[model samples]
Each structure stands twice: as structure tokens, then as C-alpha cells.
Target: MLETRSLTVRFGGQAAVDGVTCAFHRGTLTAIVGPNGAGKTTYFNLISGQLRATAGDVFLSGARITTLPASRRARRGLGRAFQLTNLFPDLSVLENVRLAVQAQAGIGLDFLGLAARHTALHDRAMAVLERVNLASRAAVPAAALSHGDQRKLEVAILLAMQPRIFMFDEPTAGMSVDEVPVILDLIEAIRQDRDRTILLVEHKMDVVRRLADRVIVLHQGRLAADGAPEDVVASAVVQEAYLGVRAGDV
Candidate 1:
């Protein structure tokens, strides 16, 4: 559903992402994995428009969106969550999600309308919060929630937008052992929707092995390998690029 063609960027005469081309299809979750500084997040930024490409293009559903800003891209069905929570610190969790639902529905003026008049928005937001297990905390300010709950809230907001493609950068990072499964389970549920496309940039091999339909290994900002998870994860490219081990050593 999304394609990046020779997508690349540079800083100080170095290519962080170098001519990498890949297509992510509907109904499949592709995991991008590599060691630090391998340009995993940088690649995401390029696609999502946080970083402009020095060269190449990004396309969503066969339309070129290489030059669109992040917000515009988001409006066109690109949903992203980062390692750091992006939220209104002062808004109640319900308000945060309600706003997303409002934006998705293209209700520009009704944001200032009374909550009583926006019963549908309230209901939709509450339902998303419940999916992320944050319904009970709807009245709590997003800033007041625990780190794990904040992560859940972020996911809840992403769901409220109902984007066609979901991009998560390190969804489980910094989450507690007990909290990890909640996020993972939600991702699994999203994957079950055959019309949705999911892109996960994650470090944990176990998590990748468990959740990914396909795996793409990046090394020095290049597409080093791409294949089925079991095959790519077990290949020489992943062994050498990801674990820094040569095939003979294994």
C-alpha cells in the first residue's frame, strides 16, 4: 500500500539512507530491523515527511507524496507513533482521542461545540480508549498517566484516526514486561485486519519474529536483505548486519 523508491537522505557528506526501495503491501506487517545508526528511524522520517529526502520519492496507495508535509501525509492516511509520546500534556486522554476522531471525520468547526452536541465523538473516543485499555483513565490528563499508560494512550489516539497504514517506531521500547503484551496484542489485532498495512521499526528480534509477516534488514542505510521473517532473520545478511557476525562464525 506504500512504496519508497530509492528513498535516501544525507548529512555532512554521509548517506544515512542510501537508495533504498521497498514496497509494503496491504495485510502485511513489515518489520525494519538493524543495529543503531543503521538509519531505521531516519527511513521512517523520510516516508512520513519528518525528514526530506535528498533524492527519491515516497508514494502512498500509488500516489506520490514525497513533498507533502507530515500533517498533510497524516490526513491522507499515514498514522505514526514514535518512541517518545506525542500528545497534549494538558488534555484529558479522552479529549486527545476525541480530537483525533474529530480530525478524521473532517469536523473543523465543531471542535469548539459542546460535548453534549458531540455524543458520537465522545462514544468513538471512549471506544478507542477501551481498546487500548485506557477507558477507565479517560478523565486523566495524558501527562499524568504512567509511562506505559501514556504509550497506550498514544496508540489509542492513532487508532482513533483510523489511518489505512500504521507506522510504529519502537512500540515496545521503555514499556514494562507486563505492559509489553498489551501493546503487542493491539498490534496483533490491527494486523488481523486485512485492509490495513503496518510498518514496525523495532529492535527486539523476538518481537520481530513474533509479529512480522516480512523482515527487511538495513545496514549502513542500505537495504541489505528482504524476505520472509524466518528466512531473513536466519540469513547471512541479518547475521552479519544485525548481529555483527560473519556466517563462518556461526
Candidate 2:
């Protein structure tokens, strides 16, 4: 579980994320949705340690982690998939994931062993790949995969970390509509694991409506709505401030 209290992220005098409080509970899928510049990603960045909060606290399972470095935060059961693809194109899919598993296993110093010799890491990496439906492409160089496949590979790489909390910023951003389903399905599978908390920041209403157990709407860097998907979707403030259309009209 993760919680942010009065989290504020400012650049100079301008606040990208205003004081806001929210929580992502274990085994649940929570979505942060809003129009462009609503500070959705900014808030996520603060919670995930990509940016330090100007004011407020971030807690994971009741421990304050606001001051922890990104690497330490990640090592403490947090994982993220960036809106932009981050992958080692020159490496094989299996190798990419192997590196992640190796890092998570605290074997980054063990360069003496051939990566292939780490059978346990290899097996676990393959298992994560299988979870994302990328098992068959494990041996292929990451550069050869399609964009959607590459995104799935990114997810697989993050999965290799065995994180307890996952933050996905626009996980389906560049994919075709058809390609979106695969990522959506993969997200659903991960959510059902009942051991991780997922925070999804996405613009696709269809995906949000389908996957979000709870939805929080942000408008102009503030919380505009927070509740069950259906409730938030129908709230007057959410429609007026963000969606610009009543739920029934849409």
C-alpha cells in the first residue's frame, strides 16, 4: 500500500502538483485520470521518487519514504513503467529481463558469472515474460520487437523486480487501439495477483472505466473527484472540470 499526504510538487513558484492526498491499496487497481496538464504524471513522479515533493509526505506501508532516493525506493518494493519506453534495444528480451532480475537479486556485482549460468534468475525472468505474454520472443533482440511487444517487454522487465507497488504512467500511450487490449489484459492479470498495488495514470477512458476499481480525477493540479469508477465518472465536478461532458451524455 502507498499513501501521499498533501503532496506538493513545484517548479519555482508554479505548482505542477498542488497539495493532494490519496492512497493506492494493495490488491486494488486505482486510476488517476484527467485532461492534459492536470498534474497526473507529476503526482505519480513524486510518489515514485522521480521528483521530490516540495511539501508533504509519501508513505509505503506506514513508513515515510519521502526522502529516500529512487534506487532505494525501487529496492523497497516499488516499480515503475515510464510513459516513454526505457529498454536496452541491443539486448535480447531474456537478457534484458535477466539484468532486471539480477539487479533485484543484488547480484549486480557478480560479473564473473555468465548471465546464462544464473538459472534461477533466468527462470524467474522467463516466468515474468510469460505473465506478459512475451515468452516466445524471449530469445529475440529487443530491437526487433514491435512497439507493443516492446512495451510488453518493458512491463516484463519491471515485473522481474517483483515489486509490491507498481506505478504505470500511460502504459498504453503509443500503442494502436488493437494493441491496447494486450496491455490492458496484462494489467488485469497483474492486478488479480492480490499481492500488489497498482496506480495507473492513463488518458484512455475505456481502459480506465474497465480496469479502475477507484478513479481519482485531477484538474488544474488538484483533486477534482475520487470514488468508485461509476460514481466518479458521474460526478458533476469531474464532468465539468475534466471530462467536459456528463457521464450519461458521453
- Give the clash count for each candidate: 0, 0
Which portions of model 1 miss their true places by more than 4 Å? 109-112, 245-250
Tens digit of lDDT per residue, candidate 1, span 177-240? 9999999999999999999999999988889999999999999999999999999988988887
Per-residue C-alpha lDDT of model 2 across residues 1-250, encoded as one tens digit per residue: 7998999988999989998998888899999988788898888888879899999999999999999988889899999888888899999999999988988998877658786687999899989888878899999999999998888888888888888998898999888878788888888988989998999998777888999999999887888889999999888887787777324345
Number of the top candidate by TM-score? Answer: 1
Which prediction has the highest lDDT against the true structure? 1
In angstroms, the error of model 2 at 196 is 1.3
- Give the clash total for candidate 1: 0
lDDT of each: 0.92, 0.87
TM-score of 1: 0.94
The whole-model C-alpha lDDT of candidate 2 against the native structure comes to: 0.87
How far in Å is the alpha carbon of 244 misplaced in model 2?
2.1
Q: Candidates' TM-scores?
A: 0.94, 0.92
| Model 2 Cα shift for residue 159 (angstroms) | 1.6
